[model samples]
Target: MYCFMSTIDPGPPPQLIQLILSYLKDGQSTTEFDLRVMPLAQDGSTRRYFRVYSTNKDSFIAVDAHKTGGDPKTLSAPNQNQTFHYLACHLLERGFPVPRILQHSSDFNFYLLCDLGEVTLCSKVLENGHKNKKSTLELYQKALDLLFKLQTEALINFEHSWCYAGSVYDRNLILENELNYFLKAFVKGYLKLTVSPKSESRLQAEFQSLADEALLAPGDFFLYRDFQSKNLMLKDKMLYLIDFQGARSGPFYYDLASLLNDPYTQLLQTQREQLLSYYYKQLCNRYPKSAPDNDTFTFFFHLYSLVRTLQTLGAFAFLTRQGRKHFQSYMAPALENFHHYLARLSSSLKLDTLVELSHRLYEQNLNVKKRSP
Candidate 1:
């Protein structure tokens, strides 16, 4: 359906284009077929994506993840590009559904991948048909099932250095990336709230306390840092995870919270609780020896849900301020998610400052609101 009349914007570099053209040509003349590159809509990250259309092949997904002229010689602190290359390769070998890496040029800073098609779990969720829910719920559960498999099975010969955003989800990452991100971007920047020195100290202590509790979860499973619907590509009636460059070793609850608390789908609290119970049962079934009991697991699940809520809000606010206006729409729903987890944990937990802030955000109806960033 994408028609190119005349304008052909030169995408990527000459060498990268040659690689793609050569691969697609498959021994034929490059001039014998039409080749076009079209930009794809991207999320909050700096990486750019494109779909390369060719007359001969099914098409390829091209990624511009970094600026040219720097190849990562070491795995330590590898950029998103290196992480994608190694992780995608490893996952593919493990029989996961990651897009096939066809070709990559380190000097040109480009990667050509098998196109995974246009369907995302978010599109399936937002459709109008009621039958979509019946089927979508099954798919959502399947996604959870995949999450569990990835968390457990993929660790056979995993290397910690493949993690681009640090090797584990520790107190420092929680404080700086999640908690402090919420404070700086969502509270202070977006909501325009000024924090007093005393309140700031109290908040820091509360964040540290939260980090401690989150670390208490049993089993260092793989945590897909952004496990929401939009990050899942639905193909062949199955869910395939994307945007996993931030994957690292961490607690089980964080990812469950990410999928359940996702604002893009806006799942009801009851549904979230049901799914949480489903995932918990799986945990018990698999790790009967090491699993936390029902009560303990529920407590930690809600705790991680609250942390995930904060991180989501922070990303929403910060990205929206940076001119990604669509994220504004999800702000209200994310605020509701914050309220949802806060209420669930109200009996066993109480962070008064966060509670107050949630109330304020709702009062504003997140006046600057929008979707999952």
Candidate 2:
């Protein structure tokens, strides 16, 4: 279980409770299952989770993510439920290890899903406490194999319209959501640093240049925006994906960067290089005509790794500011990652200000550590 998680009060709402019970009733002989709702630990999302038990059946995961507990049509934004349900069914049909959606309400707010085991890949890696244990490396290899399928086979017959915001992951998104997020959230919010107007203009120019490099990455593949260890659940020796509603169309290297540079496991450079070579070999075997050459792919890998690290720092800073201090601890590793990738691509990207800021972040982290004990 996550140390950060605690039981939230009052449990799920009334409508969600009734929906879960009714679904269980229809299948069971006595139609009696668990009505005692137990709250489960939540991720970085706004959704509420609960576990419903049963004597005959294994168990079920109950989700309550309603915008409001009112009429179904009252939802105004692009519904997360619709996207999750569609993606879950789509991936399941394609032999992906996603949870099966057992039932849902008319609004699609509440849902009952098969309980995937409680162990996340993050838990397994942390427990090992070694960066490159054979077991841990094996698990990552399996994850990469699954990732290959997700980018290749899953793209066939895939409809982008069913996705939430849109299909494409464009330069504008990079500028606003990611690069700009680093500028606003991390540089300003977390570090409490101010940027001069002239320096800010220079930063925007650098951001655009980085965005252009990002667009040059190889392949037309499905990008699992948050494909980190925490989002991967291990069950019965297989890894399953979760929290993938942010899936979009982008270059394959972005997700690779997310995985290899993930702060949770803090994989060593040697491990990362070995895995990169392994995945590249897989790509060559499958898409020989389309796969990028080693030098080109390596360049984009470093570029995208830098881009992904900046975005992660922004997210970590924002989450920490919101009172999630656990996220703050992760920032240390992420900043270390920022330094690593930035140093590699130091010549290619003109991020002098960001480079200095990263140094400050590191120093601040060290200061905090010293002040602690």
Each candidate structure's TM-score, on Cα atoms with residue i matched to residue i, is: 0.91, 0.91
Which ten contiguous residues of candidate 2 have the minimum total lDDT?
364-373
| Model 2 segments more than 4 A misplaced | 1-8, 31-34, 67-77, 362-373
Tell me the lDDT of candidate 1: 0.78
In angstroms, how far off is 294's CA in candidate 1? 1.5
| lDDT (10s digit) by residue, model 1, range 4-75 | 323554456566666776677676755577777877777787666788897788878887766522567743
Residue pairs with colliding backbones in model 2 are none
Cα-based lDDT at residue 91, candidate 2: 87
Backbone clash count for every predicted candidate, in the order shown: 8, 0
Instruction: List where candidate 1 sits over 4 angstroms from the true fold.
Output: 1-15, 29-31, 67-69, 73-76, 128-132, 363-366, 370-373
Best by lDDT: 2
| Full-model lDDT for every candidate | 0.78, 0.79
